[model samples]
Target: MTTTAQPQTGRAEGLASRYSTFMSRHASLMPTFAALAILILLFVGAQIYFGNFITPRNLSALLLDNSYLLILAVGMTFVILTGGIDLSVGSVMAFTGILCARLLSEGFPAIVTIPVMIIGGGAVGLMVGVLVQYFEVQPFIASLAGLFLARGLAFVVSLESIKVEDPIVLWFGSTRFRLGEWYISPTGILALLVVAIAAIVLQWTRFGRTIYAVGGSEQSARLMGLHVARTKIIAYVISGVCAGLAGLALTAYSGAGYPLYGVGTELDAIAAVVIGGTLLTGGRGYVLGSLVGVLVYGAIQTVISFMGAEQSWTRIIIGILLLVFIVVQRVIVARSDRRR
Candidate 1:
């Protein structure tokens, strides 16, 4: 028994050593890996516990139901990657949706209304970026000001909910493409497209590389001749545009736009981005990881619904998971520093 235990201990030590070396070399990816692992485990466990959890219809519903959140997550990923926060995204989304609904009700064409909504959101993002970059305002304070401004403007548009009747606006959410039991709505497809485009840009574009460099070290990025100001500003704009798109998706999904529609949604977006393994301090994360994070959030909600539990339980579980991931990130960061 003693001899057998010694061999087992040796193997365990060897495995641990290998893990440490891998982690030291690839510390940035650890959070993403952990998030992916948790997502897989959650899905597999839920599927075993609830026979229908992994069905095609359910899976499709997952994407469809959370499509708006997914869009928000993509934008949030960009902002967070630059080590900045955008608290105004939720409010911007609400403002755009309400504005869109108002315009459509006034007989505006979909083409006209869509651009107005997207550009409107981008404009608000530009404000935040200018405040942060030029005025040297902290991102949190600038975005909070943006949040208030957008929300106030939303109420100014209309305090009451407005129903969306335009065919083009409605079509994205209502139409579903079926592949057997699995179906995806146009909104879901659009969200996926956004993710794909963002991923490509981040991985292959000069702007994306600049974003990473800025997050890693702004001073260094500046010294290296990267356009830190432009990159940061563009990141906020992307986030705002994404929020606008999310608003559009939500409007289509619900067939109505309310000033209160996106309340607390910024928190949800931030949570998903953080859970997706994007560091709060920035410079290390992925667009695909954000997608996985949204899926995990949706999965938890679905599982809770299946169990007939209250919705708050979902928040509790997510909070615990968030705390765990943050600790993991801290450990990885510390280890990397030690290795350096």
Candidate 2:
């Protein structure tokens, strides 16, 4: 009996050691894994409680409803991964949407209007990046200025909602490809494409590697012959372009654009990115994790709606989860430091 008990104890110790070692080696992924687990559990529990919760139609709806937010999260992932923030994204989205609507209303071709909207947003991002990198302004302050500029421009475009009537624009939201009960709209497909491209860029490209290096330590990156300023500026540009795409998605989804659209949405993007396992302090994160984060956020909203609770409850729940993940991140970082 003593010999048998000794072997079991040894096995338990070995398993614990292996887990600890693995965690130390991949500390950055812990939060992402946690977010994914939470998403799964939330889905399973909701399905158990609400008999129709696990249907394919409901799953597709989740992607459809959150496609714009998912696009914004992809860009936010890039900005945040580099230890920077872009407060202007929400306003930029609103600005571009209204701009697109106005252009389409004024007889501008969809082909022309789309590129104008995208370039407009990228221009704003470039301004913010220049302020941060060249003028030595803090990212927060630079982006705040950008936020005001974009919002003011949005209002200047139009105070009232502008309906989008372009065939191409409407096609993105109205058309759905169905597989039995499951379906995906063009907007959803676009969001997925953005995520896939971003994941590949971050995982395989030299610029992507430079982004990580800069986030990890700008000075070290500079010493390593990396182009820190270029990377930072390009990151902001990418974020801005993403914001523009999000605007297009949102406008398509709603069939209208208002100057007031996307208010406080930057916070949502940041929250989703952080909740997905990206450290607020920068340097470690995944584009795929951002997708999971968006799903988790959508799941929470769905659960709250099913409970017949107030919409504000979703914010409360997300806030609590965000805090929990932040604490988890700190612990993981500390453990990694100790290991090093």
Candidate 3:
């Protein structure tokens, strides 16, 4: 009787332990949920505090204005999820945008120019990933070099803002579909499509699991037969391609490409990813968190404008929040590693 009782008790404790572990591991997602709640509250408060805030026109402007940021955030989420960073994204956007504009001006047509830009961006990102993963180069230093190279390419492509003369291309960036009082936009739709695809890829595929494994522990992932280097490299390439497409959209929305655009945007994308609950030290987080992060960022920008504050405050606010979350993530990850 004593032995039977002991076995039953041991099984109960094992079940409880598994439950606890699952809950704790998933608790990292709580911050992202909190961020989303706060963002909604802020948006509502802005509507109440500022009479003009809720107009369909103003809301549309907000969504359309930040489409590129939205796209880039998705890519950044992947990089952060894998315990890495890519600072050259902004410059890469500039490079792709200018290249697309140049092709459009030279009569390459919309279909060819757009894909070329996106592919070029991915290629550049792949090169950077190769250096970081195989050549053992630090991400910061390698991306910094990439930044300069991309900027140089942008300059070489166009000394002036080049406009796309293709009507279809312009419409893709500017046209809106009406839905009664609330309108849908090309840019917003594109952003949503990209997010959905990224979510599915991250959550459902073998490649996605490899990414998580690689991020969770590089050495362990390698021993377990994961393609850790290839996974990281692909993450970077995805980011680059997304940023490139973003730049292409920017050109359409603005009707021109200038080399100086997207200079500080990569930082904004990184901050949004972190704020949305991604661990900077890596091994945890999701693409949906990035969507929430983009909304939070846009809400903050909107609120700051409503408050009549300097635009620079956006950077300060993001920087402070980023520091706080990063420290918390480091502490959590460190403790978990010790337990393991």
Candidate 4:
């Protein structure tokens, strides 16, 4: 009997050891897991508090409203992953919107105007990246300069809001597909597509791996023969392109391009990224996490509206959530370091 008990105990210990090893191996994912839990809780709480919060129409509206921000968050995700910030994204978004409006008003077709806006946004990011990588400028300083340049350019383009009267642009903005009782706008569709593409690029591509490598340690990345400069530049380019796309989305959503649009928008994007479980110092995050973060944001706003509180409360709630997430991230990072 004793010998039989001993064999069973050994087997139990072996199973426990394997489970512990698996947990340790994937420990970095803890923050993302925690974020997911928080999102679910907030979502459920909103539905419970607001009788109509789970309605399909309202949900669709939430997606439509946040589509642009989601796109911006995707771009910002890449830059942040590289342990850098892009303060220019918000300004770039405004510039792109103004540029699109100017182009469309000047009789440029959607096909031409759309691509130009995106490329223009990418160009701004390219400039910032070049300043950071080639000129050895710090990302913060370079992006700050870019922010001012983009805003100045937007004001130069137009002092007042430019209404988009283009038939194609208006049609794109108005068109929607009905799913059951819910309608999804083209902007929402594009947002989902961008998230899917970004997820794949970040998870599977060589460039994506290089991004992580560079973020982990630029010196180590160079020692391993990774093109650190190019990777960094490309991240900014991605961010710029995303900002441009976001601007276009916003233009469609609101049917106008205001030079002052997206002021402080960078902070929102950063908040989303941070809440999504991405480390500000870089080297650990998921594109899917960012998407969930966006949803959490939308859900919070919906909750506030359902409660009939002031709209300003939305910012206050977001600030509190952002603070909590940042604290969680710090703890996760410290624990990870300790494990190492």
Clashes of each: 0, 0, 0, 0
Error of 2 at 264 (Å): 0.6
lDDT (10s digit) by residue, model 2, range 1-340: 9999999999999999999888778889999999999999999999999988988988999999999999999998888888999999999999999999999999999999889889999999999999999999999999999999999999999999999999999999999999888999999999999999999999999999999999988999999999999999999999999999999999999999899999999999999999999998889999999999999999999999999999999999999999999999899778767867
**What TM-score does each of the candidates earn?**
0.94, 0.97, 0.90, 0.93
Give Cα distance to truth, residue 215, candidate 4, Å: 0.8
Q: List the global CA lDDT of all models.
A: 0.92, 0.94, 0.85, 0.89
What's the true lDDT of residue 40 in model 2?
A: 98
Clashing pairs in 4: none
**Considering every candidate listed, which one attains the maximal TM-score?**
2
**Winner by lDDT:** 2
| TM-score of decoy 2 | 0.97
CA lDDT of 135 in candidate 3? 95
TM-score, ranked from best to worst: 2, 1, 4, 3
